[model samples]
Target: MYSTILCRTIECLTRDPSQNRKGDPGVTIYKIELLKLQETIPDLTRFLSDSECQRANRYHFIKDKNRFIICRALLKLLLAEYTALDISQISIEVDAHKKPYLPSHPSVYFNVSHSLDYAIIAIAENPVGVDLEYINKEFNYKEILPNVYHQKEMDEIEISKDKYLTFYKLWTRKEAVVKAIGKGIDNDLYKISVIDGSHTIPSSLVCNQKNLYVFSFMVNHNYIGALALTVPINNLDDILFQPLPR
Candidate 1:
């Protein structure tokens, strides 16, 4: 599954952006460059249709465009085959509380996160949620901690030391799980405590809850990542990470 995941990432967004997805003519050039990158994912090439191009154009913001491009490209990459308009199509409509979802491919669950200059797209066989945050600035941990942590957790790490990274991981993990459930941060972050770091995800998370399992990890230097997999994993090695093709 991990190999398949990385292979899919490189194969789907096979083209490179001649120019970054920033600045003027950004949207148009980005679309063109990305579409060209489709060469990387030879197997999924059949899925990118002329109609999806028209649909991608509806977005005007660069961030929105980038996200959409990755989403669409990944959709084709994931299923790795021709799909009917209704089956392959992904239409995002917020949940009751405004959580985003693609009812079209309910099984092709995913979550995307952006932190500073990086974008993370985590896709799963079932509903999934992901989030990443950059900790480059000094933040008011004292002020924000109360919002997300339970009293017991606060007591667990009672030190005069800085746990900024710890806090970010906790925050991101909570956000990822809640988002995966389509409840967003509106749910209690404290109720769902999970430890995160460079390689390990807390044991509590590995245990199945209504069939969902979450794994958290770090990327690059400053970003913290957490993925909420709707279906529990038999092995952590099954999760994969792949950089987008240049």
Candidate 2:
């Protein structure tokens, strides 16, 4: 079931920008298994900028250091692939909210998220945000449910047969929307209502003054993933999923 879709994968837009339901915005998501990154790119540091290399060294733990290095390298590689630019030509900067962006290439928007051993990178022509979380079945979601979800959402979760699944699905949506807005998550999470009946369809909402469309999917049996786009997408087939070779 879910395991079948969890391969080292990248979800891409199958349709061309001209065929988009809204404006010409093409969004693609790439899922990478961090543990296998080094084997694929032995010298990831070569792809990273000097500042990024320094940041990688700042991590006290080796695993954390490797994760940062691998993620950045993969990002640069993917950006290069999409824009037909040299990896070194792509310069990344962060906004006041700490959202990373391409200072040189504003039209190319992207977001990155990783949980446990996997990382998901989403690149788009329009503003976009993505989140991937390893669903922890043992987590005591009840302890903070009220603080994070709207009253109606909490009621829906409480009444749902699979509370954990419901919580993660909704939680990922909130995270995706917040990231898409390019604003740091402050205290307004509970105000965002993401509990629409069907999980298969993209839902529209206005958050932090930005209109967004969010869609959720399972990365694997243990992980839940979501994507947020600034523009609406009428058909699910517009988004395509590709699994990287193991």
Candidate 3:
């Protein structure tokens, strides 16, 4: 069922410009196919910090290690483009909650997320969080849904015929919200309500007295994604999906 939904979503995303959503002026998004970038890892390694290199080496699987290196290297490359700073000079620091940030360029905000085959980054002037998830039909949602989802959200999923799609949509939205707030999974997912129509354009979400707007979309059909931002949703339109240079 998810595969079917993915095909339809991809078709919608690839539709003619006249039929699709227009680009947003305030937000910039970049999507990279990790598998395609693997060959470039050797060359991209030069941009990674010593700590990053060590972190990458800690991953037991060679594929996982390579993905980390590529994601970090690509993130630095993208930040350099927007900040006009040298890639080697850009420094990343994490908050107490573990959200990464550019210490040297505080005004430039960004968030990154990666699934099995892709990595996505979102950049904006204000705080932002982006999430990408591969729809897996094999996972057991019944046992996990109750703990992770709000009662209302669980009810929606329970009543839906396509539980898998509904679960990912709700999961991504909640994760995006928490990420945008830099709280990670420590915050309760139930507190955030991102059900279908409720989070329409210009939606208002109050987190720790700070308001945010969220936007959700499909990534190449197979993946579900969402972006949470401190700015207005109207400032964001269709995501500008660009490929990573090899």
Instruction: Tell me the spans in candidate 1 whose CA falls farther than 4 Å from its real position.
Output: 1-90, 160-162, 196-212, 243-246
> What is the full ranking by TM-score, best candidate first?
3, 2, 1
Give the Cα RMSD of candidate 3: 6.4
- Taken over the whole model, the C-alpha lDDT of each candidate is 0.51, 0.73, 0.73
Which candidate's TM-score is highest?
Answer: 3
In model 3, the Cα lDDT at residue 69 comes to 92
- Candidate with more favorable, higher TM-score: 1 or 3: 3
**Model 3: how far is 145 from its true place, Å?**
1.4
Which candidate, 1 or 2, has the higher TM-score? 2
In model 2, pairs of residues that clash are: 8-244
What is residue 12's positional error in candidate 3, in angstroms?
Answer: 7.1
Q: Tens-digit lDDT track for model 1 on 61-150? A: 755655556556654443332124543454555567665555665555556676655556665556667777887547767776677787
* Positional deviation of residue 220's Cα in model 1 after best superposition, in angstroms: 1.7
Residue 56, candidate 2: Cα error in Å is: 0.6
Q: Which stretches of candidate 2 lie over 4 Å from their true place?
A: 1-25, 197-210, 237-239, 243-246
